[model samples]
Target: MLVRTFGWSFAITVAGLAFAGVLWGWQGLAVVAILSVLEISLSFDNAVINAGILRKLNAFWQKIFLTVGVLIAVFGMRLVFPVVIVAITAKIGPIEAVKVAVNDPDRYQHLVTSAHPAIAAFGGVFLLMIFLDFLFEDRDLHWLAWLERPLAKVGKLDTLSVIVALVALLVTATTVATSVPLQGGGTADKSATVLLAGVAGLVTYLVVGGVSGFFEGRLEEDGDEAAADADGAEETAPARRGGASALGLAGKAAFFMFLYLEVIDASFSFDGVIGAFAITNDIFMMALGLGIGAMYIRSLTVFLVRKGTLDDYVYLEHGAHYAIGALAVILLVTIKHEVNEVVTGLVGVVLILASFLSSVVRNRRLGEGSEQLEEQAEIPSGV
Candidate 1:
């Protein structure tokens, strides 16, 4: 199953490298490959988060994520998003922007860097809200249930999230409006743009997230029936096969899964798109490198889901959420100053690795404790 799932990814990577080599020569391929590795390293947390959502998806959506989703990531965001940014900020036609980028790479780099502050503010606050929402939510195994309970009961976190997002939007607006002469003399009206982007991000989160939560809650409410159906279906299915049903309400599960996957993908892409500025200004190169990187991230997401690594590792998803929290704060900090992409990637890799190691240590300790209990039982109760 792993081989079959990853076969396309391997083939695509080889073909993409070959194409990149022909287009930009060996140097470009080498740079893109390096960037891809860097992006993958940085987004390991994203893969774990994605695994949690992907597990709920039907096979069809999973295929869409692997196939059509690659096109959206590689071409849509990596390629088109930059052009869109340039057009909006520079007040130039996208074709002209592309031409300028191709003609004067240095100038294009300047334009992208100039826009970084606003991008940072937008991505930062959006992610921060996400982190806070997850951290404060009432989850079953929450370590600090005492704290979470009071917070969840004080009113819906969703309402609080909206309030926080609104505050962030106002703050971002005030800053962008008041600040004079951003890095370049580029006098683009960024307040409106930043405000719009923030609202869009918040709305996307609420609509997609709220709907998914509603459906998941409903599924849990109908737990016995769903469990019986799942068991019966499993009995009739092949042992090693993928097993998500498209039956009746399960379709809601699939829709919610799709929405959640897209939202998570958007969140993961934030840094990659921003960091591409440091690499090259040629929207083409930036897109190609980052797009290729996104492909691998998506592939990694599918790989984790297929392998049931999330179920096995248990704490891996928790670790990724915590990492997302960290990344969100780092992004918010980047609004006022530079945060190197290398540093961003390294932090994520270290945090995730640390979490994995902690989980292993925890599992081992539990095993030891269990063994000790068993031995004590064997010894006799009085002794």
Candidate 2:
């Protein structure tokens, strides 16, 4: 199953590394390899989060995510997205931005780095919303029951997540954004920019999430109606295979979910794109490395879905959201201070590993309890 899932990723990795080596020799190959590892490490939580959403999609939509979605992730986000950001932030044309990226990479890197404040604000807020909603929402299972129980009670209040997110943005803008020092001289007041970007991020999350939810709700209604008329018929093959809902998302619902997934990917990629400059300023190399990582992530998401990993390791989703929350905080902090990519990757990996262990322990306890119950049942009442 592992080899079948990652076969394409392996093929692409070999081809991409070969291209890098032929063009720029061993250094290029090495950087690409490093960047690929870096991307996979940093975005492991992203793969988990994606699996949670991707499972809701049917076979057709899942294929679209692996194929067409990969194109957008690799070329669109990893390559063209940076160029577009440099163009907008540096006040240059698309052609000029491409030239700068190819001919004068140092300047290009500077431009990309300079845009970090805005990028961080937007991505930070967007990701915060995701984490906040997850943390607050009521669920039967709670990984961190001590904290999550209280948060779920508070979640009863309408729009609590949005309110908390806005307050955080306001405080951050007033303090951290205002104190960011410029490369040339005195500290620059980026509070306004931060607020604008943060609001944009907030609105984007609302619009996408709201629209997707609306479609999903409609689909659920339709499914309920259809089920009512079926006279207790057996579940469909797609329903049994995917198992996200009684009916897998298709048509409009799936389309919007795909859009939401793309936006989430864009938010996650923001920091990685900027951080890649620290390794190498060659745009093509960054794209190749990150693209390989993206493909692997896609493969992993599909594998998790097929194997029903989320169903088995229930705490995995909780840990992924906690990692996301930590990352959002880190991105906000990085608006003023630099954060090492290793630190970012380590936090995610540690959280996920911890959660996996917790799940294993829980499973053991449940197994023992069931065994005790079975022993009692087997014993005769008088004996």
Candidate 3:
């Protein structure tokens, strides 16, 4: 299963390196590989979160995620997005920016570095909203009527998320608008922009999310009666929903998975994208390096899902979410200043590892308790 799921990933990895080799010879391939590994390591939490979503997706959607989704991630987000950002913010002609990125690498790096405040602010605030929403929201899955009442109340409370998102958006807009006139030595303005950008990101999440939910609800309603009839015929059956089942929870899950994955990917890429300024400015190289890293992260997500790692380490999911929350805060705090990518990576790594170890300890104790209970049962109750 792992091989089938991730087979294309390895192909893409090799192909990406080969392309890098063509561009800058052996040294380029080495650099790309190192960067790719770094991204994969830093993004372990992302993979776990993605797995939670993947397990809920149908196979067809999963395939789409691996294929089309990857293209959007590697090319659209990592490559084109950065260049587009530089073009719009720097007032440089798009063509000139691309040319500068390709030919005059050093100058390109400077442009990207200069634009770091905006980029960090955009990614930082967007991720902050995501983390906050997940952490504070009441998310309890109930399977009974008694539970439904409380759950309904929680559902209504979703308005809080919307309200918070709106406020953040307003602040972000105000900051960006005011900061425009105060370029250079504009720490206050930059800080305002960062805060506003985070708000803008929250707004984007709410809007895009609402659209996705609307369509998903319509799809589910259409499929409901057919599913009910199908369920009646299979009393002794294993509750098989088959392909339709895939379309059910799985499809919805996949869509959200896509959203979450994209958000996390965007978060992790902020530093690499910003740090690329330290390398050559050639937008191509920047894109190439970042794209390579993205591919590996995607591949890692697939590997985790196919291998059932989440099932094995149930706490892994919790840990990743916690790490994402921490990273979001770090990004927000460092908006106007420099924060080492290594530090960012280390923080996430430590949080996730701690979570994993804790999960292991908890599971071990549970297993031992179960074993003792079984032994007691075998000996006879009264004895």
Candidate 4:
């Protein structure tokens, strides 16, 4: 299963490194290695979330995710997205952005970095919504039951997550003092850019998530609605497998999920694209390295689905959403402070590993309890 899932990714990794070596020698190899590691570490939560959604998609959609979806993930996000940002923020044409990326990468990097307050606000809020919406919605299984249970109760209010995100965004605005220059010479107030970008994020989430949720079929599939269900049934509410309840809405559902997935990937890419400048300013090298890492992530998502990791490691999704929540906060805080990529990566790893271990324990106890019950049932009442 592992080999079949990752076969092409392995081949791509070899070709990627060899190509990097041919283009820029050993330094290129080292940079690619560093950037690839950086991308992987930063985006592991993305893989888990991707898997959760991918499992609900039909095989045809999964193929699209692997093929066309990969193209969008790599080139669209890692490559074109940054250039477009540079172009938009700098008021330069695409051609000019391309020239700058190739000829004067340092300037291009600075331009991109300067625009990060807005990027942080946008990515941060969008990710926060994803995390908050997960936690706030009703769920039967709680990794941190003490806190999550209360939040789920409060989630009875439809706008709670959005309200919280806005509050956080407003607070972030207070801390920003420097103004980032806009493309047309007039400066955009740092606070204003952050505010508007964040608002944009919120809107995007509403639109995309709304579209995805509209076509959703069954009540059990609604993880967010799980809180409203009775406790007893919560445990038995099975995760509907790939393309369940399509009945005939499969194509429409798949399209929305596809769009939803792309938007999620784009959100994940914001920080990585900005952070890549810290390693190197050359856009192509950065894209190649990061793209290689992205391919592995996509492959990993597929592996998790094929291996049934989501079902086996039940709490993994909970942990992943928590990591995303942490990341969202980190992204927002970055507007007021400088944070290490390593720190961000470490936090996610810790949350996810903790969750993974917890799942193992739960699974073990459940198995033992089932066995004990079976043995007791076998014994005669007189015995």
User: Against the true structure, what is every candidate's RMSD?
Assistant: 5.0, 3.6, 5.6, 6.5
Rank list by TM-score: 2, 4, 1, 3
**Model 3: what TM-score?**
0.79
Off by over 4 Å in 3: 18-22, 139-188, 214-225, 231-260
lDDT tens readout by residue for model 3, 1-383: 65666677677778888998998888877777766766666676777777776665667777777788778877887777777766877798888777776777666666666666566566656665655556444555222236444535665665665565456545544554344332245434565555556666666666655655665665666567557757677543333444355456545655765675576577667777776555445566566667766766676777787787777676677677667767665655455345676787888788778777877777798899999999988996677
- Give the local distance difference test score of model 3: 0.65
Q: Which ranges of candidate 2 are over 4 A from the true structure?
A: 232-249
Clashing pairs in 2: none
For model 1, residues 262-342, the per-residue Cα lDDT tens digits are 666766777887786666555676776777778778878888888888766666776787788788766655555467888
lDDT of each: 0.71, 0.91, 0.65, 0.86
At residue 357, candidate 4 shows an lDDT of: 99
- Model 1, runs deviating above 4 Å: 92-94, 142-158, 168-181, 185-193, 219-246, 380-383
TM-scores for all candidates: the values are 0.82, 0.95, 0.79, 0.89
Best-first order by lDDT: 2, 4, 1, 3
Ten residues in a row with the worst lDDT in model 1? Answer: 238-247
